[model samples]
Each structure stands twice: as structure tokens, then as C-alpha cells.
Target: MTISNESDPFYKRLSLNLISIGLIAAALYIAQDILLPLFFSMLLAALLLPAVKFLQRKKIPKIVSIILSLTISLVLVFGILYFLTTQVLNFLDDSDMIEDKFNGLIRDAQRWVSQNFHVGIRKQNQYIHDTAEKIKTSGPALVGQTFLSLTEIFSYLIFIPIYTFLLLYYKDLIKKFLVDSFRNSSEHQVVTILQECQNVSQHYILGLLIEMTIVFSLNAAGFLILGIPYAIFLALVGALLNLIPYVGMLVANIFCMIITLISSPDISNVLWVGVVLMAVQFIDNNFLMPLIVGSKVRINALATIVGVLIGGALCGVPGMFLAIPGVAVLKVIFDRVDGLKAWGTLMGDPGADKQREKLKDAIH
Candidate 1:
């Protein structure tokens, strides 16, 4: 005889959790466009909230405080971008003097094309014409798509500030909505999760800032010592890429190689870039990141890799930035929810994981 659903607590709990997971996945896929901006706004708000709160305590009106904080944030962002863009002009000037890269690549391909396909230069030219004509046919749509992507980026830049300001200005209202949304959840648990979320956001963002500053300074100084041109620009690029976790440094290295190949006087400068990047990564992974940011987040290696991958899968670059803190927030909720304590522990510091196992043994 089949077990009655009412009598099968284990199966019932598992089924409910599976359904909840499916619903959450569907909602995330369905609402990603709106949710990505809101999530970004929440993160920026977290970073700026302390400044807003300080100004508020100084008798500044909420609107004034928000404007000031956002203004400062915008200035810092634009200042960094401005500095980089100015250096880019130098690259453009250098590019004008440099020979075209494809000329050499095309020259190298001539022997293979001739030998493998018995093709002459004139035939190759005709094929190239056909390809160019194909590209011409598609070029207008490609240009339109490029503009649409830029427009989307510009819209995101505009909305993120507005959303962050509103979030900071009406944080209490948001808090109440979050706490009240869970009718079956205990008030104490709800409050605890909210507080933990706040703490996670504050610690993660602040620690990341500190880590980026340290990395940027050291990388700049190292490049300076090596007599690297555009030292600050390269350092800033590297530091920003480092924010992505795991794969970021490799991408930064490739970027550095390209810039150095173009800008440096000697080809040996490319080798120096690699050595310096490795040294910087060693210092960061061993000393700085662990002490500053990693300790604050406490996500284990497996969970972190999975979180970053999942976040990247979900929302690309923004998701990578969000992965750690998002996992932290979920961990807070999971720790509070009775049946999900094990999953939370897996997401959390593994040092305490054994303690959870022993506690379960004792209770059973």
C-alpha cells in the first residue's frame, strides 16, 4: 500500500522544498531585468548608507544626505573613468604610429592558404571581397545592436543612482516590508535575518573597498618601480578586474599583456608584467584578501566557486560582483529556517560545520 502523504513528513518536506526551489528559479529567470537593477541598487545603498546616516545625524535632511552621498560616489566613479580615458588618448596616439596587426597575420596565413587549398592571391582577394560584402550586409544591424547595448548601459547607470538614493531615503519602509512579508516567519527570526543581511552587506562592501585600494596602490607602485608606462591605468584596470574573483586576475593579465605589447618600448616589458601580476596575486591571496575581505565573508572554497559561477550564469558581470553577498544573505535565511540549517552550514564557515554535525548526533 502507498504511504499516505499526511504520514510521510520527510517526503512532504522534500517535495515542498523542491517546489519552492523551482518557483524561485522561475521567478529569477522571469524578472532578471528588473531584479538586477534592484539588487545593484541595494548593494550601492549598503555601501553609501553609513555616509547617509552620518549626515542625517548631523541634522542633514534625508534628501540632502542622499544627494551628497550619491554625488560623492558619482564623482569618484567619473574621476577614475576620466583618468583612464585620458590615458586612452595616449594609446590612440600610439596606435596611429603602429603598423596594422592583421597585416602580419594575413602574411603568415598566405603559405597555408596557398599550400592547403592551392589558392592564389587574386582568388584570396575575391574570397575576402565576398566576406566583406557579407559583413556589409549585416553591418547596419550590428551597429544598431551596439547602440542599443550602450543605451541599456546608460539607462542602468542612471537608474542605479536613483534607486540607491530612494533605498537609503526609505530604508525603514523597505525593512518593514521585508519583515512583514513573511507572515509565518517568527518576528525574531525575521529581524535576525535582516540584521545579518545588513551586516553582511556592510562588511563585504567596505572590506572589498579596502582590499581594492591596497591592491591598486601596490600594483601601481610595483609597475612604477619597473618603469612601466601608464602605471596607474594598468593598476586600476587590474584592481577592478580583481573584484570578479578566481578568473579575474587571468583576464587582467591578458589585458596587461595587450597594453604592454602596444605601449612599452621593449618587448621584455610583457614578461615583467606577468611576474609583477603573479607577485601581486600572491600577496593578495595569501595576505591581504584573506585578512581583509575573506574573513568578513567566510564563504568556503566550493561554495564560493559555485556561487560565482551561478551568479555569472544568471546576470553576467553584475552577478559576479553580487555572488558573495547574495550567498551570505541566503545563508542567513537558511540558518533561520529550521530544515535548511544544513545547507546554510555548507554555505558558511566550514570550521563550524563539524560542530553542526556533532550537535545533530547529540540531539538524535
Candidate 2:
């Protein structure tokens, strides 16, 4: 007997799954204001979990352990912020000199363009004037957007730690809730998913931190050796920006080169700056990433790029930052749930699939 289309388990499950994903995406976008802080806090809580557990094991109260962990995290965060602020202030202090140098460069560029492209200096000046007028017209909207961004940043700073503390204090309650919610699945299966998710989140975060530190060191050393002005500040900025994945390093490189050009009259220094950053980037891509971060997630490049692009489209930078860990967690859960093994494979690297196949063959 043939099953009706409506009664067919395969079609029913597929439709339901598609609807569920759509609903999830809608909820994530609609409730991002509330959820972004919570999601960010979840990552922080995961990173601090071991420290909290250790403190509790040492006879500290759960509340006190969480507070201590958050306090330490905040101190570290504030320290970095303070450094960035000081660097920015110093950069601004020399802005007048940079501006003068920039004007000189503009003149040189205008002359070169006039000689080669036959563009008049008057036309170039008029073009610059028109661009300035456009910027002036848009200045008010830009100011308003900047104000909104600052407000959002303040809100995040206020709520993230509070959410993190609550998450840590109620970790067991949350785990219990997750286990209960998956009643159709075995408790062992639910727990295994939770454990793996935590492992992936923690390892991914720790790996990123380690990778950033190494990159910062390498960059700073290289810049110093090359006598690049604002070496430490430029290095720090590049390293921090590198956290954004594929697009970040290229942006960092361009930014550094621009700043170097503005600060130095020697045209050769710009190329040297590029060379130093390129060498560091080469090392990072070849050695540091594979050793520190790549092994943690095991996502294929296609999935990672797509996830990052989708995340950026949906929720901007925070979404992009969370994409890899989020996808890794999803992969773990999918691989464990028999129906989703195919999806897990789709997201995972070829090496991971090979290992899985070998294990299955051995088991058979």
C-alpha cells in the first residue's frame, strides 16, 4: 500500500524542519536586541566555566566564584579598552602633523595624475570639493548613527556581565532544562550534546585568544624592528581586527599601510609596512591558525564563509563573531542526531568525514 503524501514521514519531517528553521531565523532577527547580549554572555560564561568550577571546588560559594570570574574578566577587558583609548588619543594628538603630510601626499598624487592621466589639478580639487560637500550633507545622519551605536555599546557593557553571572550561577538549572526539553531523545544523548557544545565553545574561544596574543606579539615585534611609528598601537589594532576572520586581516593591512603613509614622508616605508604585515600574516595563516584555532572547529571553508556572510547580513559584527562556534555546536548536535548526520557532514571538513567513515568501517 502506498502512503499518502500528507502521511509520509519523510515529507512531514522535512516540512516541519524547514518551518522550524524559518521560525528560528525570524525570532533571532526580531529579538536580537535582547538575545544578542544573552548570546554574548553565554559565550563568556562558557569560557569562564572551568574557572568557576575550580573556585567552587576550592570551597568558594557558587555566587562568589561567579563574581570573581566576572570581575577578572572585566578587569582584563577594561585594561584592553584603556590601552586602545590611550593609543587613539595619542594618534589624535599627532593629527595636525598627519594632516599636513596628507596634504603634501595629495599634491604629489595630483601632479602624478596630471602628468600620466592628463587630469588637471583644478579638476581633482573640484572632485575633492564635491566629495567634501556630500560628506557634509550626510554628517548629521552619521552623527545620529554614531550616537545610537555608542548607546548600544553602553547597554551591552551593562547587561553582558549580569547575564553572564546569572548564566553561570544557574548553569545546572539550564542543563536540567535542556535535558527535560529533549524528552524524545535519551538523557545521555542530550547531555552528550550539551557537553560537546560546551567543549566546542570553550576550545574555540580559548584558541582565538591564544591566536590573537601570538599575532599581536609577532606584529608588534615586526613593526618595532622596522621602525614603524605607533608600532605598538598599529600592531594591537591589526591583531584585534584580525578576530573577524577572512575579511579582517586584509582590512587591517590596508588600514596600517594608510596610517603609516600618513605618518611617514618616506614612500618606501609604506611598502616596508606592507611587507612586515604580510610576513606576519603568512605565518599566522600557515602556522598559527592550523596549530591553535583550525583544529578546534573543523568547519569547511565554504560553510565558514557562508556562515560568516549570513551572520553579518542578519546581525552584523556580533553575529559574525559567533558564527564559527555556533556552527561548530550545531555540527556536534547534528552528528549525534541520526537524522541530521548528513547536515553535519555538509558543514564539516573532508578530514573529519574521512575519520568518521574509518570509524564506521572499523565498527562494522
lDDT of 1 by residue, 227-312 (tens): 98778878988999999888788999999977776667687988998889889999887667656666557777788889888888
lDDT of 2 at 185: 61
Task: For each of the candidates, give the backbone clash count.
Answer: 0, 0
Q: Best-fitting candidate, measured by lDDT? A: 2
Against the correct fold, how does model 2 do in TM-score?
0.91
Output the lDDT of residue 102, model 1. 35
- Write the residue-wise lDDT of candidate 2 on 244-345 in tens digits: 878778889999999999997677888988898788888877667665766668888889888888777778888888788888888998899987787888
TM-score of each: 0.83, 0.91
Off by more than 4 A, model 2: 1-18, 352-364
RMSD for all candidates, in order, please.
Answer: 5.9, 4.5
